[model samples]
Target: MSKSKQELLGYQSHLIQDNLTYFKPTRTSTTVTFAEEIRSSLQEPKKSISPKFFYDENGSKLFDEICTLPEYYPYNSETEILQSIEKKLLPYLSNEFHLVELGSGSSVKTRLLIDVLFKSQKHLQYFPIDISEILDQSAKSLCMDYENLKVTGVVDTYEKGLDFIEHYDDKPNLITFLGSSFGNLDHNEGMKFLQRINTLMKSDDLFLIGLDLKKDHEVLHNAYNDSQKTTAKFNLNVLKRINEELGADFNLENFEHHAVYDEQKGRIEMYLRSLSEQSITIPKSDLSITLSKDELIHTENSHKFSISQIESYLKESNFEKLEMWFDSRKYFALVLGKKI
Candidate 1:
């Protein structure tokens, strides 16, 4: 049901053994890469590490917690859209196509789409790409529950998994990039990723993307910085990761997590700020870094989009918007796109 460490540059699978295929990159990065990234990110000007690092086992659990919090709206809003728009999205799917999911964590929301597809087609092939291996009986459970469904799990980055599917398989696909995961990337990086999807997929191939829509500043801020501090624990868990893996001296109690809504950038920025001046030594990277009082290490930027902005992204990424659905409150958007 759950596998940890599926974040970018995080998975280390060597091979896929069975029909429950996992995406193991042809080349593997050394363990030192983690330390290298930490060292580089903590350098002078901009102290930062990717939000992807927040998906390690513990971080993933914390995120699961954040998703269920009352203040968080994206999960519930996107689920509402998927529930309402399934029939509309179904007409585009072909009987022989593969339903590919990028960053398919838990595959919980995926059932809505698959249910609709099964009504028309007897059998279906699914490629649920994530950075984590299936921990529970996901493959067994899905196959048993859906008699005609077969799943191939990919434990790799989105790019690597998409490349594998494009090169090795020719099945027309209805790819779902749910969860607004793309928003974690900077605007340019997001476009580049979309551009890759445009290139690998055919003109008729379907693309579904879920994005958090720009809303009240307080709402966005509360979503990331909940009253219960679940998100705070989630953000600081990254430091716990470094302490455990890199032999780094990071006192969790000395740092506090906070989030801010960046109005101009249309993003929610999460950071871990040092409470006081302190030095941390990471033996793996052979690096020692000192923090000033209240110094912040930027952890993530979750960008929200307006409808107009979404249209611009769709056009620039070579996708034509086919159908768009939003929650009753218009807090989230799920758009079905056609590759142009």
Candidate 2:
């Protein structure tokens, strides 16, 4: 007799019950705080919005689509680099360490490292920290796929996750901040972020980081302004988030996505350019703003780095650079550092 589908998949309940634990802050950032951030950001003379705001459910879905576009080389290049670095990383991988990842969206690239670590160890512990509830599904899938793997997920900001990990002394950890999310912050902010991680890490604990490398201007430009307009959609979705969650009336059509590689700055700058003069109101904050024709609201900056800069950042943050790998085209990098 054939078994029912439920019976065939019944092990998932056990996996969730026994192998997975999720930690979320009792009070996550509220919509009121979000409204205040929006108000404060717009009030700036230059007019801007935090790129961190661009990950509401819809924005995240749009970004996932953008990643598949032909012009988005960072995601693809970083994945390729990870695929080729397993053997070289073996010296640092062992049964005695835990894997902790920051901004582990979908965890597609992490699976490669997991496979590498499993070669030397029978069981593994993984902690993926992110603000999205995708943590639940990622933990469930990982637990079911690897019988010996256990998962502890944290749904919170990077700082909060670091605070949590600082208390977890079960074993040395290989903490990872991947997918060039580090580039999202300006230099000072990035330095402070790395320092905080350094403080949370034990001596000689591993730190793996992925970064987008400095490349030709054309390549950088195309990567953010994809031909499919998916990148545009992702950028505009931030406006949609403010509209729905912050009670703002933003005519998405009146804003156009603008991305350009600023070679002098060694970064790609993304902005939402107002098509014409327009006044927008947000009821949540009782804020009103006017934008002149072609006025720009800076949305994001993705800073590309050279190897020396990466080494400098790691060293300044009290880490010793262990090794670095790159894709064939040198379009992205994976650097492994040890806490000093």
Per-residue lDDT value at 88 in model 1: 77
The sequence of per-residue lDDT tens digits that candidate 1 reaches over residues 147-188 is 778777666667777766665455678888989788898989
- Which one is best on lDDT? 2
For model 2, how big is the CA root-mean-square deviation?
6.8
Q: List the residue pairs that clash in candidate 1.
A: 1-136, 6-131, 6-132
TM-score of each: 0.91, 0.91
**Overall local distance difference test of candidate 1:** 0.81
* Number of clashes recorded per candidate: 3, 0
The TM-score leader among the candidates is 2
Q: Residues 1-340, candidate 2, lDDT per residue (tens digit)?
A: 1224223322111234688976665543554477888899998889999988898878878887877888888889988988887888887877788888888654678788788888878888888888766544556788889999988777767777766765655577888888878898888999998998888787857999989999888888888888888989999999999999988999999999999888888888999999999999998977999999999999999999998999899989998888988899999999999878
lDDT of each: 0.81, 0.82
Report the poorest 10 consecutive residues by lDDT, candidate 2.
Answer: 5-14
Clashes of 1: 3
